[model samples]
Target: MSGFNNRNHAVLLPERLARFGPVEPGAKVKVRIPTEHRSLPFDQAIWPEEAAVLRTVSRHLPNVPKVLATRRGFSVQTFAEGTELAAIWGSKPNVKGGVVEGLASLFAALARIPVDELPKPPAGWPAFGDSTGFIHCLIDYTRTRVEAPAHARYGPLFGALGFPADALRRFSDGLPRDGLTPRPFVLLHADLHPRNLIYNEEDGSLHAIDWELAMVGDPVHDLAIHLCRTEYPNRGERQRFISAWHRAVRAANLPAVADYRRDLPWYVGYQRVRSVYTDVIRSVELLGPAPTGEELDARAAAVCRVLARAWAPVGLPGSPSLGGVRAALRDWAAERSEPGPPLADLRARLRRRLAEARTAFSGYFAGAPAPLPPDGPPASASRMRAR
Candidate 1:
């Protein structure tokens, strides 16, 4: 597919494969497979092995896709039948009228769902009304899952850019795990953003897809993620969304937001910090072992933007300029190569396989051919699609 917005590899199976799709009405259908790009340990997932969380949550949320099935390890769900929300609200997002009201109502409905009715939560989930403990869970997951795993390869790069080895630890230490206002834990879409939302102008309704990162946590945590992920046209529009969110939460009788004003910034801060590390590492992976001038520049520009925003949030000693970030990424990549080799010889071998390695990860279905080809060879995903 030309557009792949999710962390998972998703495909719209052709009509012949309709027997493998869910038994819903004759609508568009797609299947999802977890991406092999082992980049980060998810802070948003509580049960890593549970593939049915979306299906379970869908059972309760009617607007959510209900007839989910699995085939050859791919989770099949009906395509959201509407215009992509991001397309409706272009780069300059509006905050007034039905857009604001509809988004607010969606959040309110999500909050109102009784936690018991949803899927069984993971062990060691925060006790009832434990906002502080809830945040700690996320911070710890970032440290243990995201940071620790990436340390061997990316630790030095982080240090080079002024991120302390103990950044996550410090953030965790400063956080109070119990005394903060007790916000009741509730279902969080965990990855909600305009791209994940589908808007139907006919009925003025919004539907959300991709609940792979969904979790049960403090409600404000949900708001913090939405605020960070969705691009607002301006500050006033952002505040409007927040105001609408509070109004809707109160109307839903879910008092999981009492101290959101005080707590929102840090949760927002945490997300920014997480993005810096994740973005840089992702750049390195995308560069592969042999990045061309254009590839390096493109990745550098993106990383530099995220790195610049992260200085204050992660307590970096100094702000990162674009030039410095490009240099750091360059040095980091060079340092990763082995001590002895004809660099040209090694790269020649790697370059031949790099194209297949990248696309196949995102497109390979069990026993299915590879994904879209790069024109060098007929990739298995592309071949399967053609057949």
Candidate 2:
């Protein structure tokens, strides 16, 4: 209720939990309306199956929200009562020991869910319990669902970034496959960032909401994603949490715990590379129809940071220089512009038409646009020229 607001006759809730509640004296119900589009393809494919999964899992896990009713694109659940864990611990350098223990217990319980009891995975899911194969499948999804679709949508803008169509495939191929032994899969709360966790201070219980991304996979992969997304205060805290996790899973007799050290790095790397595609696409989309020179520079800098970290893991080329990025973006904007009524607009229209004619035969790939020319002016200089 804290983040909910009424707008246009709809109550906005967090994440994909859409619309609910006009607070009467004692309303205790919440509604979740699935969104039309999911940012990731896996979520898109598996979301329709979540209501059933949640219903099944709730019978086993008390902290999971109880589904009171469900229909296509919408469901009603009992409103979870507690403070969001993010509000309490997200900015803190460290959390109390009990909090860590609670989280560990929660994950262990989820892992104990009988895999046979859960619904079948959506189509194209890899064989059950094949952790390495599952990751390979994700790499392919990154290419087909994330990169290819993004390229098709923002062809001209992305083309200027100098990545070839098979960039993701190349990146996936670069990953080491030597120690990827198969392990028994278990139910996993795939997205386990702080925001998705609810902590009841009085009882010291942690409730996990948001089953939209849940699946059965290698339990260690779940742990890896949790650690990456949660952003522990420091390496020591992360290690402590990992130890707690190992104890919990080992107690539950989950076999995946044994290979945690060997497999974690690979899963973490995959998470980082997966983020690259989404972040780059989101950054470009944020540029809107018209962006200031400063905005372009900032966007480029943000993207470069992600690319720099991901470069080794994904086998990417060096990030373009800030100047190069600015020029490339500027050129893309200019090419995308159409004729307007003013004289300045006429020049833009002329440039766009000429560009089209030059690359017309290439369909969309006529002249290979290089990164901003080396001699191009800096962002400040470009802004001055614009003025």
Candidate 3:
């Protein structure tokens, strides 16, 4: 048994999770989520929000574990009991037509979520404006705050990547109003990274967990971010996911507000920058306790490289400049190649973990239903006041 505390309701795993290969399937385990604001003032609210969303999803989704147990700030559902995809990404062979098919199915499911029915960020949380505004925040955080130290350490590299300060702000300022239009708002799992996904070995069912940042917003926000992170430097894989998403949208019968294909490139860029800021913050926090100057320099270089790569256009949908992105990535990778200490290895390990997760996720689309149509006629692309 494990002890409970201010935030978590601790549950011990039936077997040691790490021993079962770091992540395992079918062994029962207890997990805890916060019931109070122990980590952040707003943390307590997230527990209830998660429970509510889980309930809604269970009710609507066929394969999800129905609610099994509950407590004040925590609930235990029958673990979907599957292999975490993050563990096996790099080694997986390319399955013909699988990646795109799976992603499209995932997008269609996301599109089906009724925007108004999902949870909201607390009263004063930072509002995500339109996608363009969304892009601006990414640039500001990365260029001004997140990547500041990195820029200082690797000034020449930053310039080489063409990532000047205020790059996002400048582009945002020059964009037309139409550029910022929000797709029809919908429920979004803001942090839809790989660890949050589990694939049941039994039936190849995909179960998504971790709803800490889940909220109502443009459905494309989640889709774009997922694709950007998963397919970033891989042109073939990226195109596959985009195609899958479109098919899923069409099949799910969800509203189609506009041509998602045309808007995808812009949104992909938006997500890349957003992810750069997020990753930098996480890296700094993880490398705690002022290490050697060499370590800090390497950390900074990594952040700069990611920003530069994020800014490189992945090519517009349907008009992929075949070898363009590949050459760019190769060049970026070659220029930044330098040996550093354990911190560089740590970053590499983390990235590998993400890649593994992407691999594990590849197996879950086996039974994806053909795309559904919009639930009804598409809603007009109108802006909503940031609440």
Off by over 4 Å in 2: 1-27, 38-44, 93-96, 162-164, 177-179, 292-294, 317-387
TM-score of 1: 0.78
Ranking by lDDT: 1, 2, 3
Candidate 3, poorest ten consecutive residues by summed lDDT: 378-387
Q: Summarize candidate 3's per-residue lDDT along 5-53 as a digit string, tens digits.
A: 2112123332323242323444343333332111112112232446677
Give lDDT tens digits, candidate 1, residues 198-262: 88767877888767678888888888888887777789889988999999987885576687898
Clashes of each: 6, 0, 22
Put down candidate 2 lDDT per residue, 83-182, tens digits, no spaces: 8787788554444578899888888887788988988886878788777788887677677777787677667666676555666677677666564667
Error of 2 at 182 (Å): 1.4
In order, what is each prediction's RMSD in angstroms? 6.7, 13.6, 14.5
- Residue 305 local lDDT, model 3: 53
Off by over 4 Å in 3: 1-29, 34-48, 65-72, 94-100, 120-168, 180-182, 231-233, 288-301, 310-387
Model 1 lDDT-worst window of ten? 378-387
For every model shown, what is its TM-score relative to the native structure? Answer: 0.78, 0.74, 0.58
Q: Give the clash total for candidate 2.
A: 0
Candidate 1, number of clashes: 6
- Worst lDDT run of 10 residues, candidate 2, spans 2-11
> What's the lDDT of the predicted structure labeled candidate 1?
0.64
Candidate order by TM-score, decreasing, is 1, 2, 3
Q: In terms of TM-score, how similar is model 2 to the real structure?
A: 0.74
Candidate maximizing TM-score: 1
